[model samples]
Every structure is written in structure tokens, then in C-alpha cells.
Target: MTRSVRRTRRILQVTGVSAAALLALSACSSSDSDSSASASASGKLSGDVTVFAAASLKESFTTLGKEFEKQHPGTKVTFSFGGSDSLAASITGGAPADVFASASPKTMKIVTDAKDNATEPATFVRNQLEIATLPGNPDKVASLKDLTNSDLKVVLCDRTVPCGAAAQKALDASKLKLTPVSYEEDVKSALNKVVLKEADAAVVYKTDVKAAGEKVEGVEFPESADAVNDYPITLLKESKNPETAKAFMALVQSAEGQKVLNESGFLNP
Candidate 1:
């Protein structure tokens, strides 16, 4: 048979009896369902599940998104990754998304306070800050204080971003005031500066450094302990695909999901 003929047959099959069965199964997991939330764990998932997430979660969330699609063949996982604060703003401004995974509770509050979440946010994982330096540690930087040197061109996430907030908390705890050459909008942007050799170092999440691999070197600082960020996930109130969104959220908080995140260098919540 020709390719178009095969494609038409596939479309017809999807809209047949199988589609009705899926819709029936999906109702069991819908936010309005009287069924327990756990029903979503085993129910059929379909349609598009759009997620707005923190930039720090890009790698791990992408891994989970692929797995979500694998688990439910007809479902698609689309993501909008950026600074947590900016993402929250978009959601509250009526951007359509099924789920929201924020890098910090403070940013999540923006959505929750606006009553934009269908469910209470849950802390799924935590992340800590690390100094991302150019490969070979060209500056021989040893601690967070090392970045304070006026000679080093350092980058940091903007203060409104989660990673930036955590870095500031760490700095305050250490009583150090390090000025960065630039403040990028998100953690990835900050790390990109170091990776592209635009800056000597940047303060970013440990996961980001691990994701960068050979592109940048990670330096651990004791103050990071004082600034660990809690990552939260929630189902959006405006989600058009509640069943699939709940299933995706369940997968994110599942054991298998935790394994993917842990492997990416995120700490347990």
C-alpha cells in the first residue's frame, strides 16, 4: 500500500472503538472525577500535555516527557522551559499549560496565589548551586568567594530567577558580596555564558553543570548547602487535558521519574 493510504487507515483506526475506550478510561483520572488521584497512575492517557517548567529542569523533564509518551502512545508532551518566575507569569497571564514545575516554591507561589493550580503543589526534588567555570578551571577558582575577584568575568541568573535567588541566599549566608559582570534571565543562560567562553564563571544548578559535561567545569561550594532550592510540580487549573496532565504529574513524582532526575544530579526532596 502507498504511504498516504497507510496513514489514512491509521487515522481511522484511532477514531474507532479504541478511542471510545480511551475516553472512558481517561474520565477516571480527570480532575473532576470522584475517583482517587491514584487512578491516574494506571489510567489511559491521551492528547497533548503541555508543561511550563524551570530552565534547570529541562534535561530531566525532557527525559520524563519522552517516557510519558512511550507509556501512552497517543499522548504528546510539549514543554516551555525558562526562568520559573517568567513561566509563572505566563501561566497567570492565561497561557495554556497542563502542568507547572517550578525551580522554587517562591516562584510556584505566584501560580498558587493566583489560584491557577488544580491541585496543591508538591515538592518533587531539590537542587543546589555550583560554580560553572570554563573548562580547565582557567581562573583556578576554588570557592564562591573566588568569583568575587574583579578580574573574573562572572555571570549569574537575574535576581528574579530561582537560581539567582538561591545564589543570593548563599552569598548572604557567607557574608560575601560578589558582583557579576552580567545577570542572565535564567540558569541556562547564565551557564551558557561560561560554556560559550563569554564569562569566566557562572553560578548555576549542579544539574546544569552535569548537563553541560565537557562544556563547563563544576565547582562545589560549602555555601550551596545553605541555598538548596525546592522544586515543585502542580496541575494547572486551566488544563484542557486533565487526565493526561495528572498522569504526567504522577510520572514525575514516581520512582522511575526520580531515578532519571537523580541521575541528572538533582537531590531528593
Candidate 2:
């Protein structure tokens, strides 16, 4: 071969080898990216997520948590359900929970204000106060005013909790004065009083009454319209499993989650 031809061939072979090497590296990078994306798309979530939620969310959230665990096989969801204010306190006090779902924005503010939330809180549900009474509503409590009867043993939630705050608002709107026999710290506690026949009536969320089942009868009062508690939820800043926590939050806002809440008597946010 001519010297020029030999030189040109050598140059071409070198260029060809370099191109092959470049192509192989590009292919490997693309493969890695595709694998990462595929893993993400498969929704492979695995972790133990702790959720602090409102007392009234017990039944519905429990159902949703089971569904979440089913969808994310290796994932576990543990819950702490109580008054919204108390839950907020725990979160603000450095409780290592993955998510926080409050019954009212006011209580959620406690966490958001303390910068304990990872994202801006979103309202997930709204609830209104209802009169929970003995089975069949033995006292015939039809409206908010009926609870004002001095003879009836009525229990109210502590003013600090979402349910209690809502109850107070409803009473203020109705311009009625009531002296409850006892003020419970949470809606569930107030509802339990009626369920146990310790109190004749208690003002609690409609969802709570439904959760109580045959133990108590619910009375819809117009005054409840004045006070609707907006439940807010968010991933906490201290969440050890942020990705799993976010997935759970998304599930709670999904259609399936809403269905469970609706079935439990909670209104849509």
C-alpha cells in the first residue's frame, strides 16, 4: 500500500476505535438511567412510616394504612391517633414521625409555624360537629339547643382540640349557653363518654359517631354549619423516610383514600 494510504487507514482505525469506545460508554450511561427510571416507575417503596393523625381519623386511616401496606409490600405503617393539638405538640416537640395529619388548620399551624413540616400543609378533609347520644337518641336530642338542658349530662371536648374548637364555634353561632358535665381532651374521648353511657350527649365529629356504630346515635344540628374543621396533612421535617412518607401522603389524597373517608362520614376538603 502507498504510504499515504497506510497513514489514512491507521488514522481511520483509531477514529473508529475511539467512536466505539464513546458509543459503549454512552450506552452504559443510558442503561443505568433507564434502570433508575424503571425502578422509580415500579413504585418500589419500602420503609416503616409512622403517622400521627387526628382521633376521628382512626377507622378510615386504619383502612387506608392497610391498603398502603398492601400496595407497598415491604412497607409498614404505624399510627398515633389523638387530638389534633396533641399530635401537633408531639411533632413540634421533636417526635420522630414520618407524617402528621391534623383535624384542623389551626392545629396544623402549630407544626408549620415551628418549621417542623417538610412541605406546605394541604387540607385533606373537612368535618363538622354532630351530637352523639345514647343509642336511639334516648334524650331525643335533635338540635344543639337540646344539649343545653341542665338535666342532660353532656360532654364537650377541651377547647384546645379541633373538635372542641369547632363545638365552641357552633355553640357561639347558635347563641346558646351550655355547661357540659365534663370536657374531654379529644373527640374520641367525648364520644366514648356517650358510648359508655357516662354522658347523655357529646359533641363530636360525624365521622366519630359513625365509627361508634350502634353504640351511639348521631343528631345533625344546623349550628354545625358554622364550624367546619378542615383537616390538613403533611410530611414532617423530621421524617426519616421522606420518600415513603410522601408516597403515603399522596395515597391519602388519592381517590381510593377519599372513598374510605367518605364512607366513614368525613366530608371532602
Candidate 3:
């Protein structure tokens, strides 16, 4: 072959190789783009986030869960609502949970002490003890001192729960000793006793009384100021969905969260 012909052939060979390389690069780029698009379009955050909260928070949390679902379209929020101390025990026993919101810092300490806490908990709300009485206040049980009256049938939360602890503090502060006929496991049950007229009065959370609405009347007492309880919330260290848990925490700490809590009669922390 002539030298010019040979040079032209070499040039053609180089052009063909360049075209092949360009085609390979384009194919790789397209594959990556498609993968990313598929991942983005799936619209599913697949994981279970178990939340343990105090029983008094049942109604408020049910509302908040719906709101959270609205905010995070595909996320699932599973709640285990009960007495804070009982929930604490469940968490300590290796029950899986992503978050915990306790009515008292003391109960939260149980998880924190076990090193199962994800981070430092924040006080989202505060609650004080209140006297939940019959609809018409028939007994006229007006004050903490009055609870000591032998004629009154008073009930209180179990000593292990926050409400019970606060009730004790209030009674101690007033230097009044009263014998409650029963010590319910949680605030709601104690309040229920009054609602059902099983007891004449019960020392429960302000929020619980508000939740009960017209079923029972809440009478504020001066002694309640001495037993204000602080509620703390934290994410669990063993969470399978940390990102979603963090997002939920942000919502609880947000202005919107505060509005819901306040509307439900919880005091600002």
C-alpha cells in the first residue's frame, strides 16, 4: 500500500476506537441515571419505628401520629402507650423501640441508665397534678387538705408512676396525709375511677383531666404547684430508622408540635 493510503487507514482505525469508547461511556451514564431515578421514584421508606409513650399521651399521640404520617407519606409509626415506668421496663427488657416519650424524667433515666438512649432527651412539655372529681363536684372536694377527709373516697396512681410521685409531693408539701382506697397503675385509670364514680376524687395529670373533658371536672389546687412534672423525649439507640426518628423528633420540637401539645392542655416545657 502507498504511504498516504497506510496513514489514512491508521486514521480510520483510531476514529473507530474513539467511537467505541464514547458509546461505552454513554451506556454507563445511562445505566447510572436509570438506577438513580428508580431509587427516587420508589417512594418507600421501609422500616418499623416503635414508640413508647405514657398512657396520658394516648389521645395526643394518636393525633400526632396521623400528622406525622401526613408529613412522611410512607413512614409507619407504631406506638406502645402505657404508664411511663412500664414502658421503661419493656425497653430495658430488649423490646425494640425507636423512640420514647415519658411523662417524667425519672422514668427516662431508666433507659438512659441502661445506655439504650440515642441522645440527650429534651423536655417537650410539663404537667401538674389535678383533682378529678364527679361531674357536679358533689363531694365538694376542693383542696388537697380536703382529700384527707374521711368521707372522701380518693384514688391515686401507683407510686411508681409520675403522677403518683407528684401526688405524694403535693400531699407532703401541704403536710396532709390521705389514704387513697386504690393505687391505679397510671393516671388515666385513676381518673377513670372518678369518672365512673368508683372514687370521689383522684390525683391525676392536668392533661389527663382535660382529656377526660366533661366526664369529670378538674379542680386546680394550690398544692399542685409543688409537684409540677416535666416530660422528656428521646430517640432509642437501637433504632432501625434513625433518619425517620430524627425527623419525628424535629416535628415534636417544632412550633406546630407545640401548638398541638398546648391545645391539649399541656404546659410548655
Compared with the true structure, what per-residue lDDT tens digits does model 2 show for residues 1-269? 79999999999999999999999999999999999999989868998999999999999999999999999899999999998888888888888898999998888898899953657999999998899999988889988999999999999999999899999999998899999999998999999899889999999999998888899999999889999989899988788999999999999999999999999998999
Q: Model 3: runs farther than 4 Å from truth?
A: 1-30, 33-46
Candidate 2 runs further than 4 Å off: 1-43
TM-score of each: 0.84, 0.85, 0.87
What tens digits encode model 3's per-residue C-alpha lDDT throughout 109-213?
A: 999999645578999989888899999899888788888999989999999999999999998888889899999999889998998989999999888889999
Q: State each model's C-alpha RMSD to the native.
A: 13.6, 5.3, 4.1
Compute the lDDT of residue 237 as modeled in candidate 2. 79
**Candidate 1: Cα lDDT at 234:** 93
lDDT-best of 1 and 3:
1
TM-score of 2: 0.85
By descending lDDT, how would the candidates be arranged? 1, 2, 3
- Please name the candidate that would achieve the greatest TM-score relative to the true structure: 3
Candidate No. with top lDDT: 1
- Model 2 score (lDDT): 0.92
User: Residue 217 of candidate 3: its Cα lDDT?
Assistant: 90
Predict model 1's lDDT versus the native.
0.92
